[model samples]
Target: MRTGPRAAAVVCGAVALTASLVAGGAGTARAASCNVTTGPYQRQVEQFLGRPVDGRQSAADCEAIKGFQAKHGITPTAGYAGPLTWQTMSVMLAQRAAGTTPNKDGKCPTTVGRIACVDLTRQLSWVQDGATLAYGPVPVRTGKAGTETRTGHRQIYYRSIDHWSTIYDVAMPYAQFFDGGIAFHSVDKSMWNPPGSGGCVNMRPADAKAYWNLLRKGDDVYVYGRKPGT
Candidate 1:
């Protein structure tokens, strides 16, 4: 089928219909059979996808599923939570629940105090306080190449509630400066459409503020891997 926004919408509609059909037989048995064996995983799926936990694969759920599938590298983008999608989501959910530790080679630095573990490869970043996850692995836009974001150990050295760049002349709100010029700040969410950052970590406004509240001066920022599309 033709792909892009229109195709995605069509797929979502089809998935919603499929889910509704799977929920029921014909007429009299509809309400009774509507509940699929989605179980706790279904709830997790709904919550993870930011859909209402209504115990059904809703239209919203279907679209969100498609988005989740694309983000996590799931195949087909069919908008259905089949075995593969469920399994993949389960593994990721488990990881998020438990928090991420570096692999054997130590791509992430293990720390006892508060630290921000950024997985540049996956475009996800989270904050942990001595193994306790304080924030998120939410979607982030790191620097593009040439202005390549320097990896390895760093810390939040300064912050500004509303910072204006004299050099770039752009607003860098909720800015927490790390690595000299690089900062963990909020920019337009639409910027992720093309995903370019000037060696700074750009997040959504709410996420940036949340990070500001969670982190303070001198907190560790552990950046790892290379930005995938950069």
Candidate 2:
């Protein structure tokens, strides 16, 4: 993910990929047979994945990169150290830099009793109690291009632990509806998947479950920033 505001967004160029791998590790069968190709972000990805930072793709490097791409739902896993793969690494680094004080910038109001803050730019969400950090800075998938998640202040008006989307006919476990059909919910898919959610904030199952337990009906939900590609 590019850092800074949308106006000054920077796209990192990554190196080329030799082959395409599947979404899951099922493609592990061909890991050894992957052709070697170097990407611009090869060195960075290697460093991020704790592989040898030679800025070149090796059999081992291909396997490692493919595994990460698979886990994060980066399509055509392909063992390529491409922009998307590097962006995912960037997001992880940013999250690590956030540490516990996800509200350090105070973009999320501290005045609210207990607020769930969504930073769409960073694809991260966290809960705060007054000035105290209650949870997260966890990865999330927000609205995609056309169906961008609505911003501004809102509150949890309803919740359903075993909710299934009546509109999409998909399971949304631990759903906490804050804005009409949009909710904070758990998706079975990877949080890093591109094109994002259907105007809802999609979380990992564990994070959603934790939010369900920590938050209540009246909790504030503040969403801000523009999701990339929106």
Candidate 3:
């Protein structure tokens, strides 16, 4: 989609929640009905094209779909309902429906095994497993207007027992970072939305604990300025 500032922000959070599905080879299943109909996939295509996908196909639609497929390793073919095309479409739809977003920038590292890319725009993060784009929403606090969270490639450099007051009850050590003090820690249940913290990303206590258990001390965590493309 032609991601605007607002969309980009929403996508980032969604990625955090759906990242696991994208990473778990779930998108390979049969395409959901929503994908083929004028549902989430249509919405995404409309957004990406900056217009609607009428009965007549536009060159833009073809190109956009092709690009999307190519990125996900789908053969860039003519129709939009092939295995690869449908799978790609399914991931996009599922991500959005689940509150996940797409990343347009190719900045997040795809090479790191089990690494994930958080698209601040989509409010989602995704973990890759082969061609799948599993994703989920993860609440985070970006830097304030003047001190926005640094965008681009970064990693989980450390884990900390100490955390800011906002997420003190998370029960797990904060997943420390190479990017300032912005760590992935469990958040107080009350503060799960955007612009809620002093620029730190937040996750539900349960989700945070789950991640803490899954992640090790030095796994790669990429935070993107925009959502990473499927």
Candidate 4:
């Protein structure tokens, strides 16, 4: 999948683009100069975004940083290397460091057969068969602040490949309901979207489809930790 916001359009059937189209169009405009004042995480943000990593702001650097900010719905989207942006990057780095053994800490119960592990702390999800990683350490967008995704051990209770959310009126493809209305599904928005999902674990279309294929009813689903902003 494409990491940049523009890639969202490439995955048309996966995400509902009605609102994001407008936002994406606006993101094309040149960022203003007000964001020139570099914050404390300048070096880190620069390095993460693959900018020059000079620890100093430049016009090109601002544009690159702003693009990343826009992708994550970070406020201002003005390219400032701020704390929140750096914190998000840090979580991503940790997730990458986990590599294949995302459950090395054993927070997810290995006793269960064919289980799905959700690490809310890193906003990542993966499937496990015994100690083997059957699938992802893929990026995900989980529940937002007051509506945080409930943490605990649960199981897949329902499966709907093409489900519609009557409450939110949005398309939820490859949905696997594990807790109440919350499920693992694909959304039209970026997984890096700020504030997170309504409660479900939102994934990319491809990742959701993989989950749909790997998991089924009664499979264990273990979700733990708290989402960053939540």
Candidate 5:
């Protein structure tokens, strides 16, 4: 993902992809893929971000937003829909629509592909393959009533194993591209499935582990609220 905002408000490059093996293990081979059309989650993601769900926002695209936010010292709040966040989100959507993944950060990993959609409003997660939507309800802890989760597109730019928590070792990154240091990650059983986090997405032990397994360093993760069309 490219750091710093662009002078103009145009979108960024295409969705570029490269083949690479993760550090600890090899990932599953790519299956015959198809175009992912708009779905319930897609619509919700857009609505949460206060945008339209017209099949935009890819995994790589979201990751770029996170990268930009991280570079600028923005809190990883996992919610971005303001001007700065929109600036990056629009650029990434354009890049994905073009089917070219521009290499802004040459050092960043490009193995992980883009996410089809996320429905923060519904507290659900889905992985798309073509028109088929494979989804499940993911328990998350959003910001308090006053500190509601930001609504917008984002990506997973970081991950950690064996965190300080004794329950979960996996942590999925979802920082607000230009908000706060809040993020979503796997947590201990005691804190899973409850709206009690400091301002991060919390998941059950098993669910977090499963999500961690499927995620990579640069995966897109979107979050929003329970709004119409969201």
Candidate 6:
């Protein structure tokens, strides 16, 4: 049976992915991918940084965005030219005009290959794939003072796509368990900071999804430092 070309629309909250329906049959129609930002926008972003805006988001553009994000302490470190990335660039441009020094990411372990970093003091997390950063420096809420997220080297042991916290009775999605019952999963930002996770790493939904993509079972999970505020 031959199926005619049909428009495909999939929406995940604010993230929308629309597939292209070319003039041909299934062979010509392109499958959809979740990409909110694009080349032209990336080129516009490059303009603010004194680079030639060729109206294309190139690999250099992606790296430049990552560099800007890292320099401005943006989270998730995703290469997309999203609102946050643009906002950071705008702020920096303004700051430069005012002759003020700009802020950047704090610190992380200098390791090879891929590694996910969880910084308690900064309340942020990021994934660095070799010298190339794959995701985040995004905001995160970890276990409270008494039950702070374990600090040390650990490896992911299990991954539960739709995990539920039996003890807390909460939904833990994209859960990658590394230390016992504690894992990296999405959580409500409202109940975080002062009183956060029991002993798990609480991430934003988007960040959690990004982490799920970047990490694999047996991957290194280094949890270190402390979130300053309660």
Superposed on all Cα atoms, the candidates' RMSDs to the truth, in angstroms, are 13.8, 9.2, 14.6, 7.2, 20.0, 16.1
The backbone clash count of each candidate, in order, is: 1, 5, 49, 2, 22, 12
Which residue runs of candidate 2 sit more than 4 Å off their true CA positions? 1-35
What C-alpha lDDT does candidate 1 achieve relative to the native structure?
0.61
Candidate achieving the largest lDDT: 4
- Candidate 3 local lDDT, 148-224, one digit each (tens): 55566666666554432231222323444445555566544322122233344556666566566656655777776
Tens digits of per-residue lDDT, candidate 5, 112-214, equal 3544233344344444333333333343434434435566666655444443222232323222122233444444332212223344555555756666666
lDDT of every predicted structure (CA atoms): 0.61, 0.74, 0.46, 0.77, 0.37, 0.57
Error of 1 at 144 (Å): 1.0
Collision count of model 2: 5
Q: Which segments of candidate 6 are over 4 A away from where they belong?
A: 1-107, 191-193
Q: Which stretch of 10 consecutive residues in model 2 shows the poorest summed lDDT?
A: 10-19
Worst 10 residues of 3 by lDDT: 29-38
Query: After aligning candidate 1 to the native by TM-score, how far in Å is the CA of 220 from where it should be?
Result: 0.6
Per-residue lDDT of model 2, residues 98-167, tens digit only: 8888878889898968999999988899998899888878999887777688999999988778764332
Sum up the clashes in candidate 3.
49
Task: Compute the lDDT for candidate 2.
Answer: 0.74
Question: lDDT of candidate 4?
Answer: 0.77
Candidate rank order under lDDT: 4, 2, 1, 6, 3, 5
Candidate 5: deviation at residue 172, Å? 9.8
Candidate numbers, best TM-score first, in rank order:
4, 2, 1, 6, 3, 5
Candidate 1 C-alpha lDDT tens digits along 1-230: 55432332332233223323422332222222222234445666787677788767766676676676555444445456665566555545544653444333455655648888776665677887765666765767676666667788888887787766443334667877677667787764432323245577778888989999999989999888876545
For model 3, the superposed segments whose C-alpha errors exceed 4 Å read 1-95, 98-107, 129-139, 161-173, 190-194, 226-230
- Superposition-based RMSD of candidate 2 using all C-alpha atoms, in angstroms: 9.2
Estimate, for each residue in 85-190, the C-alpha lDDT of model 4 and write its tens digit. Answer: 7878988898889998899899999887899999999999999999888998899888878768899999888777887644235566887878766778886666
